[model samples]
Target chain A: MILKTNNLCKQYQHKDGLVDALNHVSFEVNEGDFVTITGASGSGKTTLLLSLAGLIHATSGEIRIKDFDVVNASDRKLSDFRRKHIGFVMQSFALIPYLTAIENVMLPLAISKFKKEQKYQKALALLKLVDLENRKNHLPSELSAGQQQRVAIARALVNSPTLILADEPTGNLDPSLSTDILNLLKKINKEEKITILMVTHSPLAAEFGNRKINLHNGCIN
Target chain B: MNIRKLVWLEFKQHKSQLISGLLAITLGIAVIVGIRSISVVSEKAVAVNLDNLGANILVLPQASNVDNYYAADIDAPTMPEEYVDRIVSSNLEGVDNLSPKLTRRVKVGTENVVLTGILPKNEITSKPMWQQSGLLGNDLKASCAPSNAVNQSNGYEDEKLQRKVIDSLGADECLLGSTISRKLKLVDGSSVIILGETFKVSRVLNETGTVDDDRIFIHLHKAQELLKIPNQVSAIEIMGCCNAISDGLLSKLRNVLPDTRITTIGQIVATQIQTNKMMNKVSLIFLIIIIFVGGISIGNFMWANINERRKEIGMLRMIGFNKATIYQMILAKAFVLGIIGGIIGYILGTAAGVWLGPELAGLPVQPIPSLILISLCISIGVSLLGSILPAYLAGRIDPFKNMQEV
Candidate 1:
């Protein structure tokens, strides 16, 4: 299993009482698998996705990524692991507005100890993969939402991670653009052999994943 | 990207803010440098004048009302002559040379002249002290040879009138200053009747380029006799071996010769110098406040910049930037700003200081180490302080929350 969680549970506490976001959730995904998690609003899909991403910790659970026990990792080690292994794409297409599309795509390589020339070549290749070569110098504000999502995808692939976690990868796109984004993901999985874990509420978006799981009342079924 | 590129990108985006910060720092540094130059120049002026005064100390009798060592009204304190004998035998501490002089105001015709009587040995020994331009010493022969035009000319001849008058008076006469001799038309060896005694003109003395240029010098005993003052002297001039010994020796002289008032030259210069030092301190304090103001301004601007770039930081972290990379980016920006601002501020400040230094000092001034040190310190200090807050703010930006907003 490339990623595994044992009896994972996440609780959000309000002033009144405990709100169970995820309850006794256990899951596993093998190397090279394309998986999609589907759920309604507040149905624990995001909470599960975040817990798997190691961004937020589960209240009671064990998370293991590859051979490393991510649940037991120190904050510093977790940050380092996040930089080295994990790539995340947010629903809002979190491209740095101040940076151009090329720079945004280069962000992951910039952080790692990659050589400058090699990092730039890799970033340019990734941008070309996303068909954003002409729009490399344009900032996020200058790009359409679909273009921004493409830039974010290029950024996510820059680090050459074993697993890519995307939240609502095409939730904001029109039907035609959504299919194009899905086709891009399918191409990346088939050609690059990168594992994909996506969280989405749209059934059509979930159809792109190789396997789809439904989260209902905090339980993945 | 790398820290250098990160800083360069930030600098390009925020050029105007950096320029504004540098402007404030430049103004503060300029003020400090200008004030520092003035104080340095004034000190140099005081040092030059002190050099011209032969020594840095002046010793007068306790009851004498002399303004300075050369003043004519100075009276020898009517104390027992044992005081002089004791001063001579004890080798007064801090005193390199102890020369006693007698000064009297006497009338030469209608003009009032101050007369000074000096012991030949002491006077000749003190010649090295008066070696500034125009003052002649026994060792340095006069440039022109004495002419015999006076002995060969008639009194009635206009060309020879001065020579004839000089011849009428023999040697052992008066050596009139140029101003006095010119006004009286007296030549070398001219005899002048004064106080019922016929005094012959001797070699006319050259100008000392001092107040002494207005006075005449005669044999000490002759001056005492001419003024009809016997056994009584005027002022005592004391030259200290070094400034370190001056204060202690002056106090000792005042103590031993209680009847004689002792004035050290350091005391005279100290009062004004002390005032100048206090003013300098005030200016230094003001400069410190100004530097801090610049620092606070820069700090505020940088902090706001960090806040404005929060979403960008979030995007970087989400894409795979670790905290260390973010830290390096922030710190690199701050360091670049510091170095650039410090160098630019230093250059602008130095230029302004050099241009305005003399105007502030009330005279022309030369650059000194103290001024440069002050400017550099202010520049570096303000730059560091200004950058600290921004660096911290940049570090604290949470990628998750900022990304959520985006």
Candidate 2:
């Protein structure tokens, strides 16, 4: 397994009592697999996805990515883990408004010790792969919703992370744009042989992944 | 790719906030530099005044006033030359320069003038603001030519040959004040007979806007011979730096010379010191207020900036930037702004100081480099202090809440 969770649990404590956001979740995805996790609102989809990416730690149980215990990792190590092994695409596309498309694509490599020219070359090549090389110099505000999303995808792959976690990658896109984003992801998954775990509420969006897992009330169904 | 590049981009994008923040720091730095310049210029003015007046303290012989009043009113009472020797031998600390003045009212030609005798020595030239024109008398130069060459030049002489012959008085040469010079219609080359003796004029002195404008200066021994007063002086002019002349010193002199009364320049020095102290205090208060006010303004601006950029911060975290990186970027922005503000403020303030110092204090000032460096640090330090809280806030932004909001 490229990623695994053994009865992982995460709880948020409220004034009343403990509220379980993720309770005893267990799942595994093999290498090169594209898995879409589908759920309704408040179904622990984001919490599970965040925990799997080590963006948040599990309250109990174990989370292993490439056999490294992410749940017990230090904050620095967790950040390094994210930098070197995982890429994330958020619902809003989350492009830095001040940076050009190419600069945004170069963000993940910002903390890396890569040479400036080398990082720029990698960013330019990724923008090319996303088919937005002509618009690389444009800012996020100047780009359309679809073009911005394409830039975000280029950013996620900048560090050449083995796994990509996309949270509602098409939530703000129109139907045609959503189809384009999904096809782009499928191409990256198949051509680059990079694993992808996507979280979405749309059934049509889940259909693009190689396998689909439905979540209800914080558990796999 | 580094924090600096990111900070520059952020600053470029947020022009309004950045400008306001930098302006505050610049104002604070300007105040610091301006105040420092003012202090330096004021000190220079005080020093110049002290120089012009000859000494921090004056010692006058106590002639009889039925009520301990004006010594200048007395006619015959004179302090013996022994007092001068006694004071010098007493080994008083901090006495840098001393000149004994012996005055006699004598008829020279048709005018009755106060003829003050001064030793033509280094002590005479040490007095600041004393100006003269023309040459030392040819007779005096023949007697003391090479030994007094440097001093003749000290009297503001412009001509090389004239300077070599000026103010190097022997026993008979004299300097006349502007009043005496104009009254007698005398240029520097004129001569006047006094008490059956004659002396050539060495210079026609400039008007000092002081009592020195009314007197004529002659060599000490010559005045003694003319007045028939051997080994007696009217007063002593002693000048040293601050704290050198005080009441305690006067008391010691009185004990040594019980027959005579003594007066010191305590009032003038005290007043100058108090004035300097008060000015420095006011400047210090202004400096403190500027720093705090500027810091608060920058702090508020940074807080608002962090609040508006929460989503951007979350995006950075999601893209794998650690909390440290986020914090560094925020502080880098503040630091760069502080540096820019400091340099601009330094330039403007120094320019103002150089222009305004002489205009206000009537003294030229060149602010030291150390003062500029200190002001720069203060400006940058205030910026760093103001941005700490906001940078911390930026580092602690919750990606989960940010995602939900988006």
Candidate 3:
């Protein structure tokens, strides 16, 4: 298994008392599995993704990603784990506004021991893979919605991570651009054999996944 | 792709905010350096003035009530001129320079002008201190040199004569004070009748802004012969050595001359010293105020910057930048701002000091190179200190919380 979570739970203190954002969630995904997580608003899809990526601490859980326990890891160790093993894609295409397309793609390797020329070549190759090689010098604000998302994907793939965790990756795009992004993700999945756990509200996007998981009210249905 | 490059790009993005922070530090350092420079130069000028104006101590006849040294010899009771020999023979350590004078009111063209008799340096029969101290040598020479056409013909050839030390004066020749020379229309090499005796004017003294400006100077023996006070002097002016004066030279002189009235010009030096001390204190107070105000301004700017870049910070964290990295990035930006601000502030402050020193402190100042390092340290220190809390807060920002907002 590439990813595993057993009896995962997340609780939040609200003005109205304890609220369970995630409750005893359990799931598994093999290497190269294109797993799409479908959920309603506040259905714990993003929360589960965040917990798996070690962005958030689960109140209770056994989350083992490739034999490394996410829940038991220190913040620094989790950061290392995320840098080496996980790639995250967000709905807003979180490309730093001031940096160019290639520069944004190179952000993941900033703290790495890799040589500057090596990092640049890697980021350049990723941009080419996303067919944005000609627009490498353009900033995020200069790119269209689809082009920005492509740059985001290139950034996500630059580190050659074991898994990609995408939260509503196409929620901000129109249908045509959504299809293009979905197709690009599907192509990366089949060709590169990189596992992807994507959270989305669209059933059409969910259909692109090889394995599907649906969530409602913080529980699997 | 490195942290430094990332910081540069971010600085470009937030140019306005970063510039504002930079300006705050620059202004604070400028004010500190400018005030300090002026104060330093002013204090030096005062010390030079105190050293240049001679005869801090005066010895007058016991019956005289005169407090002013210049007027101490005018119509004063006479003391034995042998007292100069007594003090010289005593081999006192602090007696740096001495000028004994005898005065009388004499008619010159129907106006009664004060005629003061000063002992010639060659007549002092002891080792002179002027050679060692060069006391009143260069400055006095510069003052006596004719500054305008009206006094251009009043030049003297002897070094001591130009220095106003009067190593030797002819019995028939007299030095005219600036005011007296102008009033009587006298010049060097001109002859004037004083007390029914024809005397040649040797040189016209410079305007000293003192009672001496209105008096005429002649050899002591000549005045004694003319006035018939053959063995007496009105007052003895003493230039006490600086270190000796501080070590109770006045008391020592008083002990030696028990029958004479001795006084010191300590009040003038005391007032200048007090003013210097006050200026130093004011600069210190201003330094504190600038640090407080500048620190707050930079802190506010950083806080606002961190708030605005919350999403970007979270994204960096999500992509694997740890809290430490985030913290370093913020501090690195502040460090760059401080360094640039410091250099620019030093240049600007030095310029301001040069321009304002004369207007504010009545002294012309030069840029002190040592203050550059001090300005840099203060600027960098203030910038870093102000950003510490904000950097910590930025590091603590939860990636998930901020990303969720996006």
Each candidate structure's count of clashing pairs:
6, 3, 0
DockQ of each: 0.29, 0.40, 0.39
Query: Candidate 2 docking: what grade?
Result: acceptable
Once fitted onto the true fold, the runs of candidate 2 whose alpha carbons sit more than 4 angstroms away are: B57-118, B122-238, B241-264, B347-372
TM-score of each: 0.69, 0.74, 0.71
Q: What is the lDDT of residue B145 in candidate 3?
A: 15
Ranking by TM-score: 2, 3, 1
**Comparing 1 and 3 by DockQ, which wins?**
3
Give, for candidate 3 chain B, the lowest lDDT window spanning 10 residues: B144-153
Model 2, A1-221: lDDT tens digits are 79989898999889999888888888889989999999889888988888887777789989999988999998778888888999888788888899999999988887789999999999999999999999989999999999999999999898888899999999999999999999999999999999999999999999999888888888889
Top candidate when judged by DockQ against the true structure: 2
Between candidates 1 and 2, the one scoring higher on DockQ is 2
**Model 1, C-alpha of A91: deviation from truth (Å):** 2.5
Estimate, for each residue in B336-403, the C-alpha lDDT of model 3 and write its tens digit.
87788888888988999999988998766889999999888888888888889999999888777534
lDDT of 3 by residue, A60-172 (tens): 97899999999999888888888888888889988899999999999999999999999999999999999999999999999999999999999989999999988888888
lDDT for each residue of candidate 1 in B1-406, tens digit (9 for 90 to 100): 6657766877887788777766777677666665665655564444333322444455565567656554523444533323444565554544434445566666678877655554444343444443322222222211111122212222223311121122222224566766676666778878776556777776665555544545555655566676676665666555443323323666777666776776655554574357457667967796777668878877776777778787777656555566666767766665565556555555565566577766766555555555555566666667676777677666556656533321
Task: Give the alpha carbon lDDT tens digit for every residue of B256-339 in model 2.
Answer: 677766655555667666766777887778678867887888889898988888888877876677888888887887788778
Error of 1 at B120 (Å): 11
